[model samples]
Target: MTDWITTPVEPRLLRGALDVERTAHGILPHRLPAWARKQFPDPYLAMVEAQPSGVRLALRTRATAIELDVLPTKTVYQGAPVPPDGVYDLVVDGKLTGRASVPGGNTHTIDMATWSAVTRPGPMGTARFAALPAGEKDVEIWLPQTEITELIALRTDAPVATAPRHGRRVWLHHGSSISHGSTAESPTATWPALAAARGGVELINLGFGGNALLDPFTARAMRDTPADLISLKVGINLANADLMRLRGFSPAVHGFLDTLREGHPTTPLLVVSPVLCPIQEDTPGPVAPDFDAPKLRFRALSDPSDRTSGRLTLTLIRDELSRIITQRSADDPNLHYLDGRSLYGEPDFAELPLPDQLHPDPAGHRRIGERFADWAFGDDGPFAVSGG
Candidate 1:
């Protein structure tokens, strides 16, 4: 009997369904990236709350050798139309096989003629890709584009290997869009992904876009899930969403951590604050929506005067978080605190300005990923926080 081994992915075409929602910028209709549009045109749209909007992709094989590519959509500051030609390459069996050209990268401008498949709308999007030949084949997929949001890889068959058993258990993380991979070129390139890989740890990414609100339900969810190491990246969204005041934030943060500690009294927990955002570094008052068009969406927050004057800053967030951690540390030694600037900072911002006054670009993602890998796994790092 031949010992058939499962591969990470099979040799056939692939299918995907993306649940996403358009927020902050509501001008353009929601659509797949340029590369995806080429294969599947005419997707459906709908209204949903709390859940991400859905989109799908189908990969098929037209030739004996299969190849494909993608260029993910990126954040265009204040909806300033993304650039053209955000193309990506597709690979099969560790070899470059095909290519995709995402014209404009966003707004459904993909043209995939060399391959075959139909794009339709159902739940998410109904799309189909060809399957692989019979027998065992090893497959590894990579995304060449650097954009934000989620990319889930589903295979037609089970992987040949089981989850490797390292000395320690897996670490499941929950955080903001940053943890979801804001401007990462590929899934594996995200900072969290890179950190997990470097640590040789299994990871379940529960990162939702604009969804880290320190909610009781989310905290309970984390409390209920099984994990070894747990971390939460907070602050920026609360500030951006204009959700609450400092007084309200402190208790909410404590409640969030308290709930997690209930389930994991001894689990090493890391609390991370927001990275540096120049515009909000030293300014006060909120960004007023243009009353003329509530949905116009603009950068009312970035002001040369405010930056020069020194007003709103991440230091405020860091200080608040530190105060909380200092108090909690007296009772919880397993608790750890991390400043986001340790991963990316003002100096780095000079090189990569995040396009929008917020969110890291691809290069920024790379920098953060590398820095995190070094800090969290270094000789004296806190990779493992033991408890009595």
Candidate 2:
């Protein structure tokens, strides 16, 4: 029998994380930098950023079998059914070869009525995968897209090393829950991930669930991160969270762009408006979950008439983003805009409606990914050949 070798999970073996924290349990990958985390230390932000949406361990090895120890913390809404365990994707030589899920882990339960949460800790678990063709190959362990995962240990039947460079462009994306892959089948099945695969670029997803409200710190993070391509899927969370009005929204958008330009003056930046969410299209938001339904559903709580004032709506946001992008284009040719409806609109809703009047189903994610690949990464797209 071959003796199993335990390897230290180093930073070089990981990809897509802006920072890695050494916790008492293990090394935790963080999408947001330390400064940003300190500035806006919202529990929700901490959860989503540490959830490792597009984060993965990239390494080279000839191991026939491997095991990873992790402490996964899954979020749960009270009264609503608990979601299934998150999946771990194993990709070898650029192909998804295996998938697994850790059996037991902590559960963070949230009470919707009071908007409070309590975490019930559980024992650590391991994800194991076996059987390889042979010879050294690049291996990527895509962590759970929604769960906060603390990587504890890595043991393999053979030695492991750093992954070889593939010279792929780094794509940095920031958005809301949809971009965070709500209801998507797996980590790689997310719209951004699928698009990245098609475009042949490295993905750094900053799509925090329910937290894409034009925060200056978030924009600063995007500015500081080294990325060949960058995109911002704006509006959904902004409207739903009802963080600001039209007056503040426009300036916030400008400030966000200003920060990005500070770090990358000429990088191809795409600002995407919100997709067609019927509930928020005409209605002002501050959306709330409707627990009356069997499955979780959300309804727009703000008044539609408030639009007459300075309230923010999906339509208003789209128009503002379009006008801003059009004006900014004169000075910055690299800056561009895409109506998110082009990715998912009424036509899409007719065929593939959002499951809970909020997030798209797996099919919708795939469709969005396919269309985005053609529109943004195709021959005539912005990232055509020399994206950098």
Candidate 3:
């Protein structure tokens, strides 16, 4: 091991987190505040929120190399082969400069066949980035979006300090796994990150895989956070989770917006619907896992005939969402709605089909990100920068 100076991870260096929890092993960053976390203590919620979707450590240093000791909680599907290792993206001076991953951490194995799970302990590991240019420059080590990471230690050959703030507008975004960088090539390549780069804004991602269920705590979390602009990508998770019916969804959505508006009455709030998921477009869900194939796939389990009974589907949710936003927008001009299909519609799907019949691939992510930037941050868009 190389001799190096170690520094404690401080709050000033962290971006995109609402709070940090000090654990016996290391510091765990949380996108949801402690109060909100306390309210919903399910293991699933804890896992996804602690994954640090868009969180990163930003600082300035002249060190030629840096290392971060992390304890990651990796998830494994019991019968299938292990998933790819989670990735950490290193950004230098606002550009993606490197990528790395630790060797081992904790593991949570789930048997889709039985819907049972178990947690096993794993050893801590280190991620090191070397060959950085020797000069005082800004560096951001973006944590893994798919793993629950506890930052153990940060080491460098030279002294490190908090980097100067860029004074960019903070854009708070909430969505599902797609927004959580699910199939993106890397952390910074997630659609939201890509849009932030193109829009010249700072990002605080509240995207939690399999957990953006319009929870009251989430809306309250969004209400309390500081943001110049805000967005909600609703539908897919709700449908897939089969969380509620159409009647319940409308009021739940209205109540969610009401809570957010209480804190940000005039803030530009954009409500986005679901992108095309051919499986759930018309079929109602509680999506079921198709484990027969080598690669795990999802199938909408609810019947089309069930729609009359108020079962949720992408088409039904999108229509209700558009109506809700339209009605609300008449009285609150700051509120706006964007049909998600506009971002990834039929034509795009034909070119870049969702690999698992759900989440988009890397190319699809790039396409969605670019399209979003053009529409949401364009000259006539609601989030357009002044004088742009």
Candidate 4:
């Protein structure tokens, strides 16, 4: 076998990464450690949506390779008995590079650490580091089976740039499961990824699975981060978790935006309501089925008489948010609003239903991506396209 000579690294690699990707997996270990197994009693708990919920990093590199010092914003830990095992695919310059695996899917393997998880060998780890092929490059991170997470190359210095970079202006988005790319096939196919691609701009997604509840800390995070454009995909998580009432939601959204305004006073900020989800569209909240003790299953009881009690439909929330944005826009010209259905709606749901009835499938992600791109960056849009 002939030996392959390694390519030299370039100076451009030292700048912060031009893109990032999330490709995590769920592992159901055959053997569970006494201390690790059976963390959560429910079986569904074991499938803790292993996708990387959020990512933040300050990339640095020498003349050799790009350094990935990643800060995972959220990693779901269900406390199940057995840890899940799987590998995430990594691609650079439109080619498969290598894989990153969580051997045993240890829930505590990556504990609640604030420091970044630096994949020292860069996107492909150290195994096949030479495949990066030196020069202006286009990197894409693909999910194993679904399109739940993806990061596109905004800027690079590889041999060939398949996806060219626009301007430095970045559009940052924050949301719940939808934003987290639930059930989407491949990472690049997600709505946010699609939108960024269509607009040809960089993106910083802060979507957290089951975690977008108008949290003050998240607002602070947005305020503290740097961005040329900003948006918050709200309502779904609050409705799903049944965390707060309608009365509390309206004011909470205002507060969240207010906090971000402190940091992004002039930046265009768009607020997105929840996408269309039929199961709970009109239903006030989730009602668990009755569980018979003999079957070892728990059930939920919901009173049909109470419609508004549990239901926080997308239509209702979207309308309310629109009203709020209209009211606030008079004072804040930078504020904007977009209906969630514009991303995904009843028509799309009829074709691609979410497995859990709350999340979007891969096809649904494509639909969302297409619609969002058309609405935000299409010729008729209020927003302008960015090109470098």
Alpha-carbon TM-score of each model against the true structure: 0.62, 0.98, 0.97, 0.65
Q: Which stretches of candidate 2 lie over 4 Å from their true place?
A: none
- Of the two candidates 2 and 3, the one with more favorable lDDT, higher being better, is 2
* Colliding residue pairs in candidate 2: none
**Model 3 Cα RMSD, Å?**
1.6
Arrange candidates by TM-score, highest first: which order?
2, 3, 4, 1
Candidate 1 stretches with Cα past 4 Å from truth are 1-168, 284-313, 385-388
Best by lDDT, which number? Answer: 2
Which candidate wins on TM-score? 2
Each model's C-alpha lDDT? 0.52, 0.90, 0.89, 0.52
Between candidates 1 and 3, name the one with more favorable TM-score: 3
Sorted by lDDT (best first), the order is 2, 3, 4, 1
Clashes (backbone N, CA, C under 3 Å), per candidate, total 32, 0, 0, 31
| Residue 182 error, candidate 1, Å | 2.4
Instruction: Name model 3 segments beyond 4 Å from true.
Output: 1-3
Q: For residues 15-130, what per-residue lDDT tens digits would candidate 3 score against the true structure?
A: 99999899998788999999998898567777788888889999899988899999999988787778788889999999989999887789998787776779999999999999
**What is the C-alpha local distance difference test score of candidate 1?**
0.52
lDDT of 1 at 84: 39
- Of candidates 4 and 2, the better by TM-score: 2
Model 2: per-residue Cα lDDT over 5-84, one tens digit each: 99988788899899999999989999999989999857888888888989999989999889999999998999988899
* Tens-digit lDDT string for candidate 4 (1-388): 3233333222132112222222342111111122222343423222222344222111221212332212122233222123223234444533446554322111232221231222122132121233454444455433322111222221222232134433456787888767766445444555787677677656666665556678676677678777878888898756555667777888998899899999989787888888877755655554222233332221223333455643565556777899999999999887888988877777877778665567776677777877776777667553454310
